[model samples]
Target: MSRPQHFGWFLARGFGPQGWGYPSLDWDYDWTRPEIYQEAARTLEQAGFDLVIIEDAPSLGSADTIDLRVRHAFGGPKHDPLLLAPYLFQATRHLGVVPTVNPAAYLPYTAARQFSTLQHLSGHRLGLNVVTDTGSARHFSDSAQLGHDAAYDRAEEWLTGIRSLWRSWEEGTLVRDPDTGVFADGSKLQPVRHRGAHFAFDGPLNAIPFTDGEPAIVSPGGSGRGLGFAGAHSDVQLALAPLDEASVRAYRAKIQDAAIAAGRSPADIKILFAIQPVITSSAEEADRIVAASAHPDDAALVQIARKQSSDLETDLTSLDLDRPLDITIFGDHVSRGSIQRLIGDRGEDVPLRAHLTALARTGRITDRSGFVGTAEELADLIEELGDWGNDGVLLWGDFHPVTLHRTLDELVPVLRRRGILRREYDEGGLQANLRAF
Candidate 1:
């Protein structure tokens, strides 16, 4: 029998209301209100989703100037994901709330304490999505931005320190007794003293062990080093890959290999691929929605280029649109995965302008992987991928409430009927629920 697959939602805005853009006015309630997020959380819980991940970027935009970013609200004026977790937890019983956090921006001690507190309060339904700030180093601190691998190196150190802190207070240390007037067994508490490459921390955590265990750790990245970090540390790995069985299978194998090399069980880490599904009653309506979401003209194409420029940290506007791109010029500034997707097998001779225009037209450059069809068709696609060894998928839409509702109302039922998705969450916290699969 095929085991049921796990499901999670990727909240692109991190509890913010900017995802649907001005069109959100159609259903606009106060974006600042916590009720909106709570409602979404309740819906997910009802649908039997394992978790909801809040994606965040402290710095937004990659253009030569901040004008475009400001005009579009591309990456600014966002609310903290951490603040929304409590609201979500209060509104739901089983759904895990995972917030994106940059270790570079927060000290290990602070991160450990904050997550530990949330884990306790939420009944161990908390998860931390560890991400590194790649835009600019100055945004994080006065120090220079580290290179890709170096950033992961710092993250590894950060995680090590955080884990030490979490383990500082061992189980059975809290003995709250009135007869002897004893509270904690100090002898059982040990100090975590560490002097590492990127951080130095000493002593035990101030918080008590509140959950069944430490809060679950989630890691998102596609690079080799990123995979290694996830294999070694994360209970869940959020992967981005082309929507094909072969590609996904290869990626899964790579991750499992990394886990084996790290002296960890391959089954311990779950890999969830990011998917954007556009489901409507018919294929035509879904196609129409996809078409409407794309860039309509040359000016819009330029806008896409500008966004890519911001991501690549280079001025793409100056390059001739007709000329082939030289990938080496961008060096390590741009994400390797982005570069691979942009250039593909066409080689460096692919025209910069024409390529960007094509990407804008198809919405591939901006939206990436998407499936346009009815809910049944989507379920078929998902089932096929799962059969190819994918553990699960991270579902996302255009950040419209309608889209999310349709997914819950239409798509999830189809998946459930196929016996591929869980009918109900297992009896446990997030970690136990995740590991149950």
Candidate 2:
């Protein structure tokens, strides 16, 4: 893998409690602080990151949530991601800003217009992470939250309509035909009338066509419905699993297969894994920071695991953390077993105790391992993952944006020196960045 490969910055106000792969912050940090986000964005731009993926969650499920609950108590100074787009766009010249949006919450026409406007404002630097509401029904009106497959079905139509509206006008469609005294070419614009199972659209969008086409589509989901959509349209496919070689390989293979099945080249979609790095001048210092950091409570760990586990009913929190993890605990959730297989494939032949500790040390080590080291050491580890089975990495931020900030300042340059990271922004827009792969 060379400098042209994908390396994106991941954000979630990591500085607070529940930092990446660890517990949240002590006192909840003020996420709305402009200086906070600005510093983070500046770091990534300096480091030559391909994009900044800012995630959005509607709400925490509930109070008294178990440990590892992604729903936090009081996330700070939050604002709509769309409103923040220009802030990040203005902060960096080339870093793509990908913000997730749910089609269910807003009309497709409105979203199309917003993103098209964003495309013009950002100079085509925006990317879209299309989501079809994997959340609970309570988040929407009684009529909105449809079944899973139905949601995707509706999404397909929504995307189709959005695309049509984007091409509604061609470049130079607005002609200064002063001879005819015409302000625009009317024939070049067309309305998209779509009537699908879940949605119906019949009007032309309010904004002009974005010549670059809709921002590069990214899908974080990989379930049957998700893979089908992503394989057909997504430029980047986000995967979350333990950071182990086998896990990385298996996930990538599945996504490729999905892409191939969708009648698109498997290489069209890049697989991105979340990785949080702790960097220092020396590898030992990085190791010390990781070692010194406290793991979130056992309950939190189990709850986090439960979210991805197919067998959500099984409560792993009650089990003794000291006890050797019984594979039987994953009974019925074949996916959980698949996760365990990844750890076992690592070629370690230690006793059950050591294996258990290895599993516990990483908190349900499905396959991925965190890299804690100096910049050079971290870059080497990234190279190792690239060799193993990673297209690129999504650097997870802990403590607001501090983890990402440090990475851009310290680690990225090391990778660049080794010819593993880009020295300058790739020419063109967000879609161009993803298409370069």
Candidate 3:
């Protein structure tokens, strides 16, 4: 038997091209329009998913690398996810739309008012996936570029300010007396004056309060500082870890410990691991796909190189394939951890082609190991996570109808049969759905 768990989808490509360069493009869905994502949101809501988190990185690569960023469509060319959230909300009643928002891009007071308005509009189903990427600071006039930990600090301060604004309306502030035609009691509204190292704002946000519950907070950071911020403030922690039991336990323990250290209950935070499982029709097909990736041809290698170039903001496509990359190729701005992950078990002496080749290969989901598998096999991995006391898994993919159906069509039945996925949503909304199990 398996315990029921919360599930979500991560719009891995943000609001960018939904099916560009992929076979899904043949479906001819206009990625620029809202219909593609609205349909996807309905599919997820009908499938009993609690939320869909839209990932965003506000900047194109640095000035010198804009071509690398948009050429392959690996990054950039994204519209604002916050603006897209309302369409998603209008599409589904229970599905939470959590768009990635950076403190650097939005002012505290404006964000507070906008988010609160959406919360009420969505019946408390709106959520913000707070990120602290400083790469986009250059785009905003008032934004200051900060180091990693400092960026987290600013985000913490920024959230603290927004929440303060959300709580500005007192318990008895709304006294709608039809007889007197009085809508609100002005004296009951509290003045919110906040002055923090990163932000200063005054708000008794004009937006009405959320009746179900305030929009649930979501965070996606794996560093210690990131964990601390999430533990202290986030309702859902977008986690990443090895799928095995012990690693799952350890990663969960870190989140639990962080919450406890912050005087917060571990139960208050739901840790949903991020996974991109390639669902195959059968185990043999999974094996065949995995084997075919081992010796990636020139096209495959270049594709990987283009993606890496976008991520590192340094061109890798023109590099000599036979030679090891220069250690200095990455700039001071690129994340060390990201570079290390891309390097992946390679010494400095390893050839650039060898590194990209390794990335092209993937693994199976057998023995609770990897993410490539059949739908039934993927269900087993999810059930095992539930057994390990995991909250759930967030399926990472583009928000396209074809992509959504491809992943969920076969897998949803398997999960539903095993009692791993919910058949229907509970009353209130997304918050209610998250708290249902």
Candidate 4:
């Protein structure tokens, strides 16, 4: 009613680790050191974080690829996100655990059962992040990644099947009737014999459906097809928008429009932007931390920019920071298609190198749109974000555990005191907490 709490919580792995920072080999982490996942879960639990996102990627990209190698420590080794979930859930009573899973890699029947089992175990503190493949289906030697629109079609079918499995046995369907030695009432159990172009599954899942029901779906698809798929099925559409105000507003408009076109409530979809908060007792100290943590390598900077804007291919050394960027050098590899389209529309003729450097500088230093200040100042920045139509921030870690802790300990309380954030968590899973909001 009072603008239903706008922001929600989400965290990822590798954000804040005591063991490693940029330029260090990612695998070099002292595994013996306290794991970031555990620490972050505890931190979020104490801070009333609504959800933690467990990223799903089969293997790290090779160090040669610009996008993956730099930010991820030149192709870092990893742990299974799902494997970390139970501990995370157990460690934190109220936080939701959203694990990213590529449906193409695993069968729906198997995934449905696994999610259902987890929901039962975690007391419905589970959620799914459905990501269709990026481009190629090389991840699957058996089957190719579904085509653009087709992938969503498959996702819709896949979601339907999963829900069917969850709802197969209604309440009181399994009656312990001893009079005639009949153990159950079989009428409510419906076999979900779902068969489609991309997937096929028969009957109910192996596991008993959770008394709390199936996990809600969160989709991060901003691609046209992906957005449509999310609008049709997802409980929360996790969106990543640029730092610029115009960019953020435009993306919000587009996603909400897509949601409306799909006959879904635009309010049901929440927009989340990546934030790297560097907080200190004073604004100047926060700035110093940001400056100290800057990624010195220009190549790495260019690579990071390339991830969001795929078109820029200029060497960072050649850029003049004070000028607008030119577009012709991008040639064919247009990045994050939507952002590129925006740039193309603007028709600014600055050098490509300058453009990349500017983007790199922004991303490297102020992940939170330069929200470095005292707790009160940081709260002001978050409230500003809210005023602009965004629901919340998805914080990215700058150096390691310190960055995450600083925000939670210093800034989160400020927001809570302002009547913007929850003072105490509602008792339940991620979906329950969100629905309450």
Question: Which model scores highest in lDDT?
Answer: 3
61-137: candidate 1 lDDT, tens digit per residue: 45454665545554454678888799989999899999898887888898889888899999899999988666655
List the pairs of residues colliding in candidate 1: 62-310, 63-310, 321-353
| Candidate 1 vs 4: which has more TM-score | 1
Ranked by TM-score from best down, the candidates are 3, 1, 4, 2
Weakest 10 consecutive residues of candidate 1 by summed lDDT: 360-369
Assess candidate 4 and give its TM-score to the true structure. 0.78
Deviation (Å) of 48 in candidate 2 = 0.7
RMSD of each: 3.2, 5.8, 1.8, 5.2
Candidate 2 per-residue C-alpha lDDT over 1-437 given as tens digits, one digit per residue, 9 for 90 to 100: 34445888766542233343343344345456445566667777777778877766553432323332443322322356767778888877888888877777667778788888899888788888777654434566666446667777777777777887787776777776889998787777776687776667776666776656468777776467777788777888877766667767877888888778878888788888777665666645655555544455545455444443322233444555555555554423123334443346544333333333344453111112455666666677677777775778888764255455556667766687777777766566777777665
Clashes of 2: 19
Shift in Å, residue 387, candidate 2: 4.1
What is candidate 4's lDDT per residue for 13-49, written digit by digit as tens? 3333334544442535553243556666777767766
> What are the runs in model 2 whose C-alpha is more than 4 Å off?
1-3, 14-30, 62-78, 170-172, 176-181, 241-249, 280-360, 363-369, 387-390, 398-401
Please identify which of the two predictions, 2 or 3, would achieve the higher TM-score against the true structure.
3
| lDDT values for all models | 0.78, 0.64, 0.87, 0.61
Give the per-residue lDDT of model 3 (tens digit) for 1-437: 57998999999999999988788789888888999999999999889899999999899968777988898789879999999999999988889999999998899999998888888888889888998877788988664578888988889899888888888988889888999999999898989888889788887988777788888899987888889998899899998777888888998999999999999999989999999989999999999888887899989899998988888888889899999878698865576656876776687788898889888988888855467899999998899889889999899999878788889999999999999999988888777878877
The lDDT of model 4 is: 0.61
Which segments of candidate 4 are over 4 A away from where they belong?
A: 1-19, 22-35, 62-75, 145-147, 176-183, 242-250, 285-352, 363-369, 387-390, 398-400
